[model samples]
Target: MSSYELALDRRAKEIEWENDTCDQYDYRIAAFCGLAAGVIDALFVGAPGQGALGRLTDKGADALVQKIAVMLWKGDKRSSAGGRPRRAPDTLERAISYLEQAFPVNYDARYAADLRDTGGALSSMAAKNHHLLSLAHSPDLIGLIFSILDQFTGGASFLYKGRVIRLIPVKDARGNKTAYMQGTTFSSKLFCGICNWLGHLASDLCGSSSTRREGKTGRGAGLPIPFYNLLLLMNFGNFDGASFAELAVKVFEEGYDLRHGAAMAVPVMVEECSIKLIWALKRRFYAGKDWSECIPSSKHADLRIMLLVGNAALCLVDAADAAIRAAVSGGSPLTFVLHLNLIAWARLITLIFKELRIRYGAGVDGAFAQYLAAAGLNDAYALRQYYERMNRLDATLEQKLTEFVRETEKEYERFINGVNQSLNPACGTPRQRQEASVAFARRHGAAPERIMETPEQLREWLGGADRQKKR
Candidate 1:
């Protein structure tokens, strides 16, 4: 077979594999896994202030904040007896205070009046929800960029009331409003800005320094949920009397911050791991499949569908639990909405869109587009190279196959003309013409015995002429 024929056969098999749907049993197992995850979320990851998992994550965040603070505390001097720093910020409060002094930003404004004084327009901004309003306080790429920009420009950037507001030349601790870092080269200043950004984030991860100092036991204002600051830009929806941006701020104020975000991820991780594990186990033990075949990935149609089913089930259960709790607690819409696991729903929505695209999109072309879109091409350069090579190979095979077909047709035409010329009454007898045709068949790469066979046999011989020419 030619390379083109082999490629077509492989593509057919791939399409068949992709189209393979899961059976009822597989879907049932997926639902069971999802229900189990939902149970875990309901029992352990309810509202941020109430759930056990939320408290655990809060403690973890606090520990992380303290570790970062200690690392950044350059004031502690090394002891003569040992290399360890002596009298390091001994408590979370002390550590936070050290970081506050070490990395001060100009944009620590925590009230509407503060923004007004800075000539900014974020009136709804306050200490309780300032972190959510401030884009630089987020823990994402946008946040990083804004953080660096604010550091360099001595300003703050905030998204509030469906608009982006920038306040420039804000005063720092020294009461001097300067744009660039003093007494440092460009590179040093840039490095310092990054360190300051990270250090400030650490300081605010648990709560403000003053809040810690006051010994507040309540969930004080911390950093916004990872990427949740972006949600403040989604100012379209108006539930009750507030837009989505206001709702996002309200959510952050009500303890749906980064620590609570961590807690929400638990059920999402559980559902995903459970689905993959059970799928692998069933393939290995029940179906007696090879270890390689037992690897559960989204590439498999059945596994993808199973994941979709599982996430759907998890979201369903989580929503139901939230609804029931809300009903019991005087039926507040915000309360029910806050209880719902946003992470699980996000996962389910992603799976649904993926499944739809796979099923209804342009097959291999669509899959390739999706791969390119999702893959970090800068990091996955090897994978990008592999795809380029495959594309080149396919083009070469197609070109060769086309040339072979055209050449075969021309050769067959020439052979028929030669045979007809030999069969002319003026040239030879019947047996002589038949001998001439037999010689033509042998010249075209067929065995002499096949000369007298059917036309199919003769065409098959002609097809091999290209392969023989290559040799």
Candidate 2:
């Protein structure tokens, strides 16, 4: 009757059949059946991920149907576990029509003996294969078996300890097994590690990677292990201690909750474009040639790739910076830093996409700093870091970017002061404005007095237009 029930029951730990009144085990079988039935019914109504429209893309209601259906048929417990067959006889579209009979979830009766009979059914189907039967008996394999089963039969999300988590089976190249649960929120630390690992995949680990960074094989060859290490450290997406939910909300919300004791916030957007761009870059990078070096043999491409990737990395770093700033500003860097997360997500994805002219991503290292400047992130610390990363990778562009930030910060200070005056009409007034100006100067590594009042003065302190003369 309720949707959560349909999604949450699949995880083995949640269903307490031994003590849950009626046979929970038997009911679980029925739940699986109901899931199957739901998929069948969804053939007309649409299920979660079997189609393009299932998530981000809108390839019609049946977008991923082919992929989902194929995986489901191969996941049959009644088949030998030695390995799945390479193909299936019917298209998933056709199979969904019969889902009601095959995996019906409407009643408790259907699940009772379905999987209980799988071992026997599988052996019969396998021509009495003994080796296959033994692998089927392994407990760890059962979870994978069930997850694949859930993907096709539908109703995969389930509640554990009062939180909802959807089951998604993900695979890296080489067919190594991994899972992703969309909408599964975790603390900043865990998210950071996941971000780092995934980020490495597109930039360093992909097939085309040739050069090495900070030791270890090139980014391409080393991806799986680092990703796994990050995941293991994270205990495979099982985050137990932090309440990142508040952090999540704050990162996305319009204002920080600083009126109490928390810092003020920057705004967040619900819709995002990171994954799309990242994948696009992947296509380009693999196409060959270091697009980032396209400007000339001697010049960095000032490539957008580095800029975008650097921006995304800033999302993680900014959160840390925001926490420190929140203690002072009425707002947390997080409120504003959320922009960085989206940028980080987008950058990781964009880094995957290769630029047309060159490869190795335009030679702009620590890409996000360029993005921060481009996005007009005038925060002193966030800006300085961008220059720092670029200075390490490309001196010419670093000088250019540094000049640009210096000029922009000078302009932005006035604009912000105007906005502040309009919003807070009373108390402190111009005094707070002056203090903010002074603080902005101090943060920029600017001089204390005159630099606070005049943006031009701050620019001069940063070596301004003169910094460009040497170039």
lDDT of each: 0.76, 0.32
Runs of candidate 1 with Cα error greater than 4 angstroms are: 1-17, 74-86, 116-120, 179-186, 360-471
TM-score of each: 0.69, 0.19
> Per-residue error at 463 for model 2, in Å?
99
Candidate 2, 69-186: lDDT as tens digits:
4555566555445333444525433433322123322111111131222322222212111111211111122222322334223323221222223332233222324322222323
- After best superposition, candidate 1 residue 303: deviation in angstroms? 1.4
- Model 2 scores worst on lDDT over the 10 consecutive residues at 259-268
Candidate that scores best on TM-score = 1
| lDDT, residue 60, model 1 | 89
User: What is residue 118's positional error in candidate 1, in angstroms?
Assistant: 6.1
